[model samples]
Target chain A: MNSHHRWLLDQLPQWERDGLLTPEAVRTLRERHAVDDSQPGVAQIVMGALGALLIGTGLIAVIGFNWDDFSRPVRLLFAFLPLLVAQLFSFRTLQRGDASPAWVRETAALLQALTGGACIALVSQIYNLGGEWPDFLFWWMLLSLPLVWVLRSSSVAIFYLVCIAIWSVDRIERGAPWHGSPMIYPLLLLGLLPFWPGWPPKRKLSVSVRWAMTLSAIVGLCSAAIFASERGSNFFGYNEHSFFWLWTLTGAALALFPLNQAAIMEPTRRKPQVVLGCLWLLGYGIAMTFRDTTRYIMEGSSFAMHLPWCWGLLALLVVFAVVALIQKRWAVLAISSLALLPLAASPLVKAEGGYYNSTLSWFATLQLAGIGITLIVLEFAGKKGAPRLGAALLSGLLIARMADSHFSLLAKGIAFIAVGVAFLAFNILMSRLRRSKQLPAS
Target chain B: MKSLPILVFALAALAQWAAPLSQIWTHEQVLAKGTLVRLKCRAPDPYDPLRGRFLAVWPEQTDAPVPDGAKIDRGSQVFFTLTPGADGLSTITSISTTPPGTGIWLRARAGYVYDKKVNIEWPFERFYINEKLAPEADKWFAQNIRGDQGIVAEVRVLNGRAVLADLSLDGKSFREILKERVK
Candidate 1:
């Protein structure tokens, strides 16, 4: 049996003796879990995927040989044949409905998406139509996106999201991505959202899908800032087009989304959106304290992109904020109006600088220190997890200090590295400790 | 009701196939009737996962003599006409805002421009070849360039679309080079 099943099986007898479970329940559990030893493990699944990848790679390598002796029509035939077969497979799988295993459906959908792309690419190769790669990608994605909906395939949905991210960021390094395409990118992303979190009784998006969508949203958000430093400064003037605008807009959007409640559900009380957003906001807040970054950071809701896509979500910060004014839930009203805070701060903030020894830096240090102490006090008053969160905020705050302080660049680098090492090491240790019953249950 | 989705999936699959099919139809039309032109080029081999192995080729002519009546930037589409130069290989002679009324021409995205000269990026930058011969082709092209024989691309152009018909080194295909190496 897998270690997880063995461990669970071991727990059942103890729990029964303690009256946490009945003897009959324990017997049922043992029977269900004992058979798990014969089931495929994660390692086997990973190996299967790797094996498939290798075989696919080999096939592609052979196909890359050009089949020079074959006539043009015959080469095109090779391109279309696999795709046609994959379509027939999809039809069969669809006809089976839910009777077939999920992997079968997922595989059928993924194979269709991939083979369709390969077919397009092979056609390009055979025809010797050498153009921009994005043109090929655009058409491939255009053709494949529908399969995500028609097949109800999360795998294709994720694949489609990735394609959007790639397509949106093309030529962004030059700060001039192809116009119109990137602008409508968020709308394209939104097209998939209404279908997610499932339908009927389930009513929830899968965690991986949610995380994928979140990551893609972040890429879109970051493009605003980086793109602003180049294109926005020229057209919109700098401050009006910065990350400050992005955050305020995003924060307000998230706040408006669940409208008064957290993006989370009952019982756990875990605010994933708020906590993560807070971490990012803290980092942004610290960067703003730097002298060379631009004094205008505090001037307004700075995270706004040139396009004012502030209508977008910030990782989810108001989840942490206690402030509620005006209409009771509006972290907005006058809240969203923060879009105007950017006037001419762009004039002062150049591309680089720090707040070391600056008044703003000292003030932020005092504010975070005070909040950390207050949270510790709350923890002492019997709140669980408060002290941990408070301590993390303080340590992160200290790291921010080390970043902006008068330390040499190497010293700062070493300090950051050690902190990262500690961060990962502690998590690993905590997980083991919790499993061994040495650490307090979270 | 369930059959409706299967029908939709069938339609989606047909739509997917249509894109590559159209590409084939267009290119086949060009190959059948388009003007064939040879251009001297320096090529380096690279692998595109989708398109497989191909040469990223830099051709002899990169700029139009003088750009007339058009604002050109790195991404703007610019049409340029090709002509035979002293070496009897095609060289880009001129750029026009609109497609030229007469001679052999192809469309290219404008690259960096300087000194009133419009630089161009060739649409036919990649010349697909057999995978085993790709790295060999890269090395052989460099050698042949120094040895005074050149790698030339045979391109077919019709109505602003250019297809890389073939690549030959000193009038021989890379297949011949592979045969020599296997021996």
Candidate 2:
């Protein structure tokens, strides 16, 4: 047995003596047998570095070729060159099973990285690319995704995430004018879902990767929302309310449901981490609604008076505070301070519209009052009720805005009444569902 | 493992070597006009409207005909047939045909006319074709007697239809013209 197995065995004897190694535990241990051996050879290291250098050089040369002058066929062939070379190299490595595992892994990693680099270069070369940025990004992401599986490289996965994030931003910027294509950004997160609490490593690296992915999602959503709001005329904008809610709901399902199910099956101690990540993600969704609201108020010239109802912004700050308190996460607290700026700035900036226009003044007051009422209601809802209530309230606000924009005042009032009734009915149904789930079955 | 890196390095070296082979078309060569020649429409610097960029074609062997009475449409299509003039430059002779819309306007002289309103006849003798079509004449002179083996041009006409016709290269192909540069 290798040193790692030996070490594991050494620890097991004491555990067994202590009666810790039950039959089930022993079976699990046997299944996870480690065979860590000597460090990689000097030759292997040299070969890996040489291979990487060659691949890099080849990529540079191919991309540097006057692609602009080449015929379409020639340009396409050049684009696939690196992928072909990398795949062939990978196949050759796999065929030579006699090679050291470390060597195989290193070679695979190099090939994977080169493939990713080549893809980026090839995409940069596609000529006369029109306004379909999202579709373009989605295609690139999908093309690069297989490298993650083929090479088993997290780096490729990270690259894929970055592309998706960029795509999301592009989608948001195009607004309603942007028609949907086959590319779905949510599917990508699903692709990465299996790698969560990724191959055990130092805590710092794992946390950072998790944080990085989360931050990317947040930035992507925020950018998309901003784009949707501004892409059309200053008055009419894309309805991002449904988009945000659906995205957040999907995100929650992916992060929470899968992790919970996996934890039950694996009996792993990482369950809490998964839960924490989901909660933080939920908080982020709440936070985004407010951040977007604040940005709209500041940047949107027409809606300057509606600044007071910017309570979504304050609600977001509170959500962050609650998250920090619950998780005792210092990072959350540090970031929460940044939210204070909007609160301080919004009130200080005097209302810019004419005072004689009661429409502007009344709208501002209604916003502040509405936000104040929502916050009070949320405070009564307490910790357990906050997430669902926040979601419902935000959805209602979006629906109201859409109605007001698209319908007559009479129609708007009727729609508001219908929505209010629907909300109450949903709340009652949810309570019953909760009650039934909480009760023990006979 | 060691071989992997070495293989990569070898591939890189091979790529560097292969890159230069494709750049063989960059050099210029001279050919005589009316020497059957070929021209690849390679716009060297793509037109950048924002930057006010444009390409100017200067033909050294053949000059465009300037019509005397009719003003040439600034962007109208005109054809050329190679005929050595007194100036020793191959000039385009005008052949009558329905303007731009009907059949092969084969006998049309290659020249520039001002607006149709001016009615000026400035026929072949002003503009010149690229001098590169010169050495191409020797090849045509030796092998292409029937005119079947000469350069044919598909010129984009005013109505966007491509009109295919034999460009009167005295007797050469673009390859033959380029070959002179090596000699």
Candidate 3:
């Protein structure tokens, strides 16, 4: 029996003795909720994922090796072979419908996505096709979307998110043209949208789903940070600084989205957002506090805001704002609202050459001060992990910046001692708070 | 409802396979039954993300007349009337968006433009080989070809479409040259 079933068995005797349940009722409940004997465990899932990956990679290597020997038609035929087999497996799964085992359905969906990508790569090799990397990724994603919908596959959705993150990075940082990536990215997220609604009420998601979401979220946020410019064009008049501000705001919104949900308030359910979003926010906060970061953006004197990506960022911000308003998450509302201040300030300062440095210094100082105070407040409010890490990170960054700016050695030593004392005090206070029931037990 | 999704998948599968096949078929038909013209061009090696490495090419038009106010856009099709020179190498005499029916002309995309001169990109700019041979091809092209005298390409044109049939350097085809070099 699984751990959940075991725990239920342990509770049954106590429940009957305490008059919470009768013997007959306990027996009926136990029979109804019994664990399936044939359900695959963690080892099986890991092995299945590895097997699919190996087969996909091996298939590509073998075809690429013998690419010259085969006739044109033969090469073309081979490209479609793996895809056809994958489709046959998908057809069988669909025919079985819900009667198919969970493992069988998931494995078929995973193979389908892999083989489809392989098919694309093989065809491009045979034809000597030339296009940007994101174009190839976009086609692979479009072909896989139907499989996600037909199979109701969380695995394929995760796979799509992984590709979206990669395509975003390629398009943004490598100076590839937009190619509708900004628009298509969010639309693709809808493939995974169904999974969230169908999530079980009182249980954690399977380990594979949790890990996939975490990895995708991290990649997505990091890609946003690398949005240096829209190829050669700058849509937002203020340059990279404005996009940096947009990314920071987007990170905060992603972190807060899951937090506001009453149904998903459990720590396990909230782990992906907390780790990905809050860590990203913390890292951005640290980078913003540095003198070099300000100098990098302030050197350029261009300002105007119009691009598809800028509009896409705004659309996302509007969605976040609407949700925050509906949920009455006042703290989230205030943090998101703060992004507009720098958006308005940077362009005006940039129009004139002399004030750019002064404007950036003031902006950096305000962000550092704001983020530092917020981290401590979160720790006091009993939000663990991210708050503590954010606080440590903020303090380290402040110290590093202060030292780099040529503060006296005496002042630096005093600052370090003061930070240590503050941490000690925080630890003591947290323990007392926990004992007195002033903070909820984690 | 059950058969509906399966039907959609089948259609998507057919379309995916058909798109690339149609491209190959069009090129094959032109190669079999079209007018062949040898054009002067240059080749350089470049990497394609999925296909590994390929030789990126530029076809040189030494004596083509410059047109007035012709705005060339990348990926936009343009018609070029071809005439063979004394060396039996074809030179573009005129270029336009609409096809000229009187003489043999090949359809090509307007590539890079400078002043009155435009570099038309033939459909076959990339020549794929094994990934290991890409660096060797790049080295050989850099070493042997000089001053637009050695490089030549035979292009088959039909019904406003063209396909690259052979690329030669100093009288030998590229594949034959590579075969000798490898041996």
Candidate 4:
């Protein structure tokens, strides 16, 4: 008899006695619930480990071997070697179905990531690429993108997004011509939308994978775009052509709202997608109007005082606040503040450069303050759930920015130590909170 | 599943083709003394510091007259042919505004032409000039009082009048420089 069937039978003695299951039925149940006796042999485990070791060793050897070679063809072959091997292994595994699917997939993913890194390194080696490291990075990302769907590997997707972020920043920093194109980073995130919908709630692996992909995508895209845009041209002084391209790309990404609905299998996931979709749409609308409204307000036009774009941005914020209130998602609420935060200080500083009274400095200060407050609040309100480390890291970022502005290396060092201390304190407090919660409640 | 191998093959082919496009050449092949290499100029990257990323090329051969001032129409196109000068450096000789085929072309001050050549400098040797310094030499040639359009070439003379070297915008041989950096 199957062990599970036997246990069930033992627990239901009364039912059995009352003829709920005859001898024949019990036999049928045992047959139906029988566990497969096949077990993975020690040899298989050793082989799997050996395969992983070989893959890693091969990667290092290839990189080390070709470090000095200037031949593009040779570099290209080395870059694709791991991927080719991985594909072969995957094909064999799929054909035989002998290996654990999970392990095979994981190993394939690792190979994909290695291949991606090698591709970037090889391209960089080939290009003698100086200023535009990001452009080559974008190509690396595009090449690796197929692995995300083909291998169903979230780790590969996240790595790809990271590369894209680096590329975007590089492009913006170097002022390469990336004006009218769809921001590739955001499009890459769309791949993760599939996980947020079905089956993930029941599967911890899928949920964690989805979360990593989504978080990386959102943070990386926003940071890259902001860094690039701010560094490339003055925030407000960008030409209309540039602004139009930015808005168009953002709008197109937002227009992918229908796909979000396709993935909605549960109410918990569905609600957030709906809200995020609306916010994205509204955000783009506001971004479109931001320039014209700013111009109008600067010109002292009374009619432009209540520009529709400003209202749209404000309305989006209110919606975000309301959703956060309803869903009890404090993280979302905190992030929503970023939208209004830029506008709050714009009035205090002039458009052109000013030493102390500049809008940028004030904005930076407020950003520090906001992050600091959010950290404290998160720490105090939900001691165990507090995002203390994140807050501390953000505070550190702000301090660094301030130090950089003034060219104060000492200040930067001090700020880093302070942030580290804050992170430690938060972590310690959270541990204590968890221990106390675990104690018997009186 | 059936098409997978084909797709892989196509990708492999494309990668092979695209890989060379990113490289910059570094060898002195075809760029020896007195080569009438065409220079192609690129506008300054908006993000770079003023004149920092701007590439100015004076074709070793040109058919148009040089402008008195550095300013040229924002979007004017002019052609020049490279000439090997006595200084061993290749200098641009501006051709008349008459188009190569038609004589009715508009006469405008010729702008700089930027060209890519494999730069090779021997180890422990300082024969190769810095790219920044190269522009200064080109500028001096542009402003020389001897002619309204052309300037003296010294490098071409020094190297012995090499033939006209071909210019490639598609990054070819760039990998060689990258390999050198890796070393």
Candidate closest to the true structure, highest TM-score: 3
- Candidate 4, residues A1-442, lDDT tens digits: the string is 2345447656555666788877777777656755432222234334643565566556644553334323546666766666566656644543443344545654564564455445545433332223333554565556655554444444555566566555544443322223412244555556444433333432223433444544454445444444334434444544323333233222223223222222433333433333443345334323323333343223221222233332433454465466445655454344344434334545563554312233444454455456456645775686212255346535555554554455567876777787778777767986797688799888
Error of 4 at A373 (Å): 16
Candidate 3 per-residue C-alpha lDDT over A285-355 given as tens digits, one digit per residue, 9 for 90 to 100: 45645655654443321221344454555677778778767765543444444444445456644534543
Count of clashing pairs, candidate 1: 21
TM-score of each: 0.73, 0.37, 0.75, 0.42
Q: Candidate 3, after superposition: displacement of residue A220 in Å?
A: 6.8
Residue range with the least summed lDDT across 10 consecutive positions in model 1 chain A: A330-339
How displaced is residue B105 in candidate 1, in Å?
1.6
* Tens digits of lDDT, candidate 4, B81-116: 344345333334444333444211122333343332
lDDT of each: 0.63, 0.42, 0.63, 0.41
Model 2 CA lDDT for position A157:
56
lDDT by residue (A1-442, candidate 1, tens digit) is: 3666878987987899899999898988888777342233445434533443454445456667778668877888887888888889888888887675655666677777777777777787777777677767767776777666656666667777777777666735442443644656667776676443233313334445655665666565455444544454554555443555564455444333442333333222233333444455455545644555435554333334334344334333343233433224321222232222232334333333433224444444565566565655554554333445556666787687787689999999899888777656655764674476665757
Which number leads on DockQ? 1
Instruction: Write one digit per residue (lDDT tens) for candidate 1, span B1-183.
Output: 286676678778989777777777888888888898889888877778767788887786777755556687766777888997777688887888789999999988787778888777788788787776666766676677765557788888999988888777777766677558655
Q: What is the DockQ of candidate 4?
A: 0.06
Is model 2 an incorrect, acceptable, medium or high docking prediction? incorrect
In model 2, which runs have C-alpha deviations exceeding 4 angstroms?
Answer: A1-10, A13-58, A61-84, A94-106, A109-142, A170-172, A175-183, A187-216, A219-223, A231-257, A264-442, B1-183
Clash count per candidate: 21, 48, 6, 40
List each candidate's DockQ score.
0.46, 0.04, 0.33, 0.06
